[model samples]
Target: MTLILFTQIFVGLALVFTVAAFGWRLRLFNALARPVDRSTPKGNPRLGILYAFTLGMAPWAKESTRRHGIAYLRGVAFHLGIFLVLGILILSPWLYLLPVTWRTLLALGAALGALLGLAGFIARFAEHNLKALSTPDDYTAVLVVSLFQASAGLWLVYAPALPLFYIVSAIMLVYAPFSKIRHCIYYAYSRLFFGKFVGSRAVLPHSQQGAR
Candidate 1:
């Protein structure tokens, strides 16, 4: 095979496998010593789905470390910024397949939205890292998501051809599902379980009998 083809095959396979392995590791950890929570329920499928949807789409509505006023502003700004960018992502393929006008508007919204997210990322990193409030993985996770979004912005700035942009996006799609970024999808359900549901359930109750 040609060098370019060989490299793509090698890199893509390596990335895919590494991510899959990490996912397996996460599953093992979850099985062996689950994280503590005061929120999950006793396997109610309907409630589980509803909770997941609510948390995934509405994380900002929940309380935060920040108090009311600051939380309101931060949540509004972050979610609005995410919302605008997501709308643009939905529109991007159409822009590619359609006219310049469509492309221009989509590109503009995406560019500005990415910039906003980048700024928030920097602010969050400063707060978490410098303040020593973040775990190493937490900081790394933020950095990866920041890089992913920034890559999208860079793709826009350079106006790389469709193939290259697709390559970057594909890598991101594969990487995100394996990374802390998966929290975006699973966070809501996780919260519902650990937060609202945990306390309400009697199943998996604390052991009153002492271990011998």
Candidate 2:
């Protein structure tokens, strides 16, 4: 079997392990007891949840986001690139079938993400506030993710680099659940609780939707 073929196999296995680990973590979180609010309900919890996922995420919705708009947008773009690259990975078998134009677009998108990731890394290392807030895990995660995105960008530009991309992807996926990256998993729960509290209290604009 070709070495490239072997890399694909390894990448597939790594994906499976990463998914399983994430699932296990999710199960544990769900099994834990959730706190119940004793206060009388005044608003619709559903509306709060809607806001959490929607308007609440808007840059203008938060003071911090307003102050750090560029950084926040960079993070949003980086995450979008991450998702796009994962899609690209799944399309690996058929990637060469695409038009050169399409491939170039994909390569450019991933490259932009990699650059943003690197910028974030440098910011954390050089910025006084960010440097004080960062942990070793933050540096490791950003560097690996940056490298992974870089590999993905190159792989799209050159088909022969597929093996390298797969290898890098495998490393990042395997470490994701164990590293601080697992916080992505908690995003849902956080939103849920936010919905519950705001929806219950009739505080904020959720009252427009009426109590659930």
Residue 64 of model 1: what lDDT?
Answer: 51
lDDT of each: 0.50, 0.88
Least accurate 10 contiguous residues by lDDT in model 2: 203-212
Residue 32 lDDT in candidate 2: 97
Clashes of each: 7, 0
Query: What would the per-residue lDDT of candidate 2 be over residues 45-89, giving only the tens digit for each residue?
Result: 777777878888889888999999999999999989888888988
Query: Which 10-residue window of candidate 1 scores lowest in summed lDDT?
Result: 203-212
Q: Write the per-residue lDDT of candidate 1 for residues 52-156, one digit (tens) a residue.
A: 455434544445533345535554554454455444434444544556565565456545545555555566666654347655655555544444444444544
Runs of candidate 2 exceeding 4 Å displacement: 206-212
Please identify model 1 stretches exceeding 4 Å from their true place. 1-52, 55-61, 65-95, 125-130, 154-158, 161-179, 182-189, 192-212
Error (Å) of candidate 1 at residue 87 is 10
